[model samples]
Target: MARGHWLDPLARKVLQAMGELPPEPSARPTPAAPPEPPSWVVDVNRASASQWRQLPGCSEAMVDLLLRLQRGGVQFSQAEDLIQLLDLPPELAERWRPHLVIHWYGDAPPQPPAPPLDLNAAAPERLTAALLWPADRLQRLIQERRRRPFDNLADLQERLCLPPEVVEQLIGRVRFGERRPGPSLPPGC
Candidate 1:
C-alpha cells in the first residue's frame, strides 16, 4: 500500500505493536481543565455571616458567634483577634488568613471583661441565659453537673461531645469549679 493509503492506519498499528514504530498519539482529545474559582476577600469587622460563609472551613456556629459579636459592637482590629476569638485551628486560620482583612472605623477604649460564670454553682436559668444553649443541651449540662461537676472545658467537651465552636465560645465565659464528691451512703441499710 502507498504511504497515504487507507491501510496506512492498520499498518501503523501493526508496526507499533511489533516495536518497529513509535506509538501514535491518542485519537481522543484530552478534556480541558476546569477553571479555578475567583478569589474573595472580606473585612472581618464588617462582614455578615453570609459573606463570611464564602470562605473555606467557616462553620455556621462560628458565623453565628461572629454576627452576635458584631451586633454587640465588637470589631476586629487585627487578624489575630479573629483567630483567637473564634478559637480557630492554626491550619484553618492560615487557610482563612488570606481572605480576611481588617478595617478599623475608630479607636475605642477596651471594656472590662465580664466575670466568668461558674458552671458548678450557677442556676440552670443563669446558665441558659449565659450560654444560650438549646433546651436539651442545657438539660444535659444541668444533669451532668448534678452527677459531678466538670473539671474543665476538656471534660465538659468529652462528656457532652460539644462542638469545638461551643467549647471555644465557653472559654472565658464559663468556669468549672472543683469537683465535689457525691453524698455518702447511709451508715447502714
Candidate 2:
C-alpha cells in the first residue's frame, strides 16, 4: 500500500475523534416558515400613513401626507381634489386616482361651497384644513414656518412631515393665487 493511502485512514480517524465529521443522522428538522403578508382593504379617505404606503405606486412620503390629510379632516369629494394639495402632474394624478378608494366616516357630508384657497395669504390652519392634514402635523408645520416662509405647496409639505404620494396627490388642487399685473403703461397717450 502506498504511504499516502495509509495516511487517509489516520486523517479520517483524527477528524472523527475531533467531532469534525458529518452528522450521524441525515434527517434534520427544518425551521418554521414566516407568515404571509396581510391583505389590507385600503380606505383612501381613512387609511393610515403606513397603510397608504402599501398601495401600488404609492411612495412612503405619499402615504405619510395622505394620512396627515385624512387625520386633518380633509374631504375627498373627488379623488382629483388631492392633486391640488400635493402638486402632482395632472396625468399622474388621473392615472393613480382609480386605484384609490374613498370612504366617508358617516353619511358623506354635503360638499361645502367655498372659494379656492389663496396660497400666498392662507394661514397654516387654513392650508391644513383645506389639505386634510392632522392637527399635530398642522401644528408642526406652523412651528416650522416661523423659521422660514413657505415657498410653495411643496415647501409646506416638506415642513409638514407628509409622504411624497400625498404631496403628489395635492399638487393639482393647489392654486398659487393669481399674480398681480406688472407696472402699468407709463404714459397712455
Error of 2 at 102 (Å): 1.7
Model 1 misplaced regions, further than 4 Å: 1-38, 108-189
lDDT tens per residue, model 2, 27-99: 2456789865445556667676666665556777676666655555554655656655555677777656655
| Candidate 2: count of backbone clashes, pairs at least 3 residues apart or interchain | 28
User: What C-alpha lDDT do the candidate models reach, one value each?
Assistant: 0.71, 0.57
TM-score of each: 0.40, 0.40
lDDT (10s digit) by residue, model 1, range 1-189 = 554435467897897788777665564357988865448889887897889999888899788767755654556656865776566899999888878887866654233236778899999889888888899889888877777777656557656667655664565566666667675322110
Candidate 1: C-alpha lDDT: 0.71
